[model samples]
Target chain A: MNDFIRNLASDLLRLEINTIIKQNMSAEKIPSNKRVLLRKLADMYRETLIDYGIAKSADDPQLTAADAPKVLRWQFGGEFSFKEIALMASKGIEQLEQAIKNETDPLRLNVLNSRQKILQRICNQSYNVIGIFKLFRRDLAPDTLMQSNEHEEPAKQIHYVDKEHFNYLRYQRGELPLECIPFRSHQETAHWNNDLDWMHLNAADDLPFLPDMLAMIYKAYQIGTEQIVLQTVIQVEGDITSYITPQYINMPDNIKEVVMNVHNRAISLSTQFWNTLFSTVMNLAGKSFNQIFTRNRK
Target chain B: MTLHSIALLWKKTVNWTFVPVKGLQFARSLLKNGGHVVETSFVFGKASFTFKTVISFGDIVVFIPDPAGYYAQHQWHDLCQNPHWHACYQKYLQIHFEEIANYFHAIERQIAFWQNSISGFIGIVNIYPLYRALLLGEWFLLFFPIASALYIRFLGKVTARAIALQLWQIAKKWFIPKAALIAKILPKAG
Candidate 1:
């Protein structure tokens, strides 16, 4: 499938090609077949440029390096410090080691060593992974299990738009790449009665309430009448949700066809697009920098 | 000038900074010929540093805080995720959101942002005096009538909303439990 060509070596080539197209935009000069491809490519380039411009103009995400930790806290809604996770893991390992050292019993020693290995693995993973694990733990509220059974008709599935996560909409200045996912009526919470037709998605790795591949979907989203985002009809109201890994749903074939089709076209155009674009750039290379780039500036 | 003075200047710039003694130990210790060469202040080193904050939201930047090897040299960073490969338009809506919010004197959004943001909770928790002043329109309206008037005039439709939010907390602790109690006791017709 010809997905979009995203190689960095061709980035400059694309820019030069864009400049050539914009400056001497004579439709009659170019073949009609390539024009369609270039036109779509041009649109993508425009979006990238707009996003870059926004990023340049917006407030820096960090007020200070000190503020970085807090940003993660705000996103994930976990109140534990980084050291606590490390310390807890260390303590577990130490206890396990001591048990393994002292126990004359082979079976007990084997169990202790295995537990030690698990603790080591958890410790070895990166901060966000550990953070995600701790944040999504069911142990946060003991009464959750008890309460689940108490409700006969099932817990009131009011759209629990996590307030902490929602707050990110405010402080986020600059180019925050976001996507809108339209809610199916059935997927919504029971008491959810809001005028909002869509949910906003931020590309996140830890404890994804939405798909981690959500950002990738945004490209295909809003294409004609079809959406690129996965048509994930199911959202589990899980007690220990996304514990080890977040789950995903497959998009319909017709919708996914767009990605495949675009990918195939992009792949086919790879050599021809670059060779032509660079040849044009090389022709313009003899000119002064200002003259080469100035064509569209005016 | 003495090294003492230079150290003092360094402290002012990097206040509460770490003393990476081991990292820099070789520079002093390895310079074996120790001599008191009394010298006057001449620019030993000149550094021009400009700090700019770049906002990054929605981009996944996974920090490998403590790596197994060579973590001390400097923080290693790379573009964390694959780029999307489709024609997409990203209209930065936050800028518009901010313009509208500020124009309408909607401080609640700011308050929500601050309260949820880093070290922002501490400031908001001690906001009784600010709250009182805002309610009285001392800081926001009465004291700065011209600015206030312009804000109100520009936000003709949302001015009333602005005033309402200025007087109240969005989520008062007392209101939540009370609302919950009322909901539980009330008969439902669903």
Candidate 2:
């Protein structure tokens, strides 16, 4: 997964760089000074790729600034890319600032100032896009590559259950996972566990991230409910198996009947509970929704 | 494709459509109630300039001259027309500019914090199903798109309104006094 992510990032970066080069080359009649600036920018990109281990030193000879534009144009075709435009706009601001400083005429100064303001707006928007991209890249970074901050605490370990088990337990409780999971801090945990109880008590005092808190509650419920059900099944199975032996079978017929009847009753009640669970949940949800809607209407 | 997959695809289509609808609603709320407009008038000799500054909940500040105001229209042409008044106004603006910028920066930081929180919530809702589908092989999550769409449709408006109201309250409490101070400091011209 890490390799796949890294490769995807590298491919995207290469594509972006190629598009930028192609776009720059396709522009009609670039001034000599602007050409020099583009070359310099290309060099900067090359160095950045090398620093990030996306490009190797051996590839430098084939991928020089002079060769990049032609290769990129042939491969990706000539198209405008947003990052390239933003980069040029930023550089244009620098030139505009210099012109504004050098000009003595008030009218020209006003024009230059307006142009600079417009360019500044574009640059600000570009910065926002760049910031979002940076955030995305950081999220995609492999765990090993991610820098750890001393002040930041390590994330808490979360428990998860298989879908089948989660569904079974939820069915037994006569609730949808959505309904079972508490949306607000004030709501009680669906299933009782010491850790969840403590967490719920403290939830109001110290605000944790909402999704994490809910996930923890859900998982704890699933695990707790599954354990209780499995334990009950095991105990029932043990009792039935113990009675199946010859010595146990030889016991008083009345006592044996009573024991079997008690076991049968427990099994019948469990079966009935599971059968009614879905309908019960639906009815409860309908009632709640109706109440909310009626109250709103009033 | 199977009926199940087709149903899932339709849900996803509805979800994608709903996202932009909710986005537009949120934008409308933000525009309506998430900011305060501050107007200040500056008198300089024979010329007076009225500046209207709109400070948005997103911490964007826009300053514009009042195009319709009598003093602003007749007295102050473009600042370029009278360099002396322009220079004086510039000097005055320079003095308070840093403070205003800092105030907006603080507001921006607060907005960014809230943006992170909102995005975090969205990330969980959108990504959780994918994680389950890919890692746990949970085919039942085909309904996730519709579920999330329903979640957003029902809850998105309430959240947007609440946030907008909160922003309005904050702007009223914090920005009004600061704007009033700036208006009070406007030196009379002449």
- The list of candidate 1 runs beyond 4 A from truth reads A1-82, A126-298, B1-190
Per-residue lDDT of A73 in model 1: 21
lDDT string, candidate 1, A168-250, tens digits = 35324422221111112222211111111122112222222112212212211112111112111111122211111011123
Candidate 1 global TM-score: 0.15
lDDT of 1 by residue, B1-190 (tens): 7899999988876642322222112112111111001101111113111111101111111111111122232321111111221111011112322332231222222222222211112222333433333333344422233333344446642553355445445555668888987888786733
Worst 10 residues of 1 chain B by lDDT: B32-41
- Model 2 over residues A228-265: C-alpha lDDT tens digits? 10012222123321214332244345434433443343
Model 2 stretches with alpha carbons more than 4 Å out: A1-80, A141-298, B1-56, B59-190
> At residue B56, what lDDT does model 2 achieve?
28
Consecutive 10-residue window with the lowest summed lDDT within model 1 chain A: A16-25
Q: What C-alpha lDDT, on a 0 to 100 scale, does residue A120 get in candidate 2?
A: 62
What tens-digit string does per-residue lDDT give for candidate 2 at B1-190? 9999999999999976655444333322222223233334566655455433233221222232222233454442453355675466555444334333433343343332223222323433444553344334464762564454455456773574466458768989999999888787875431
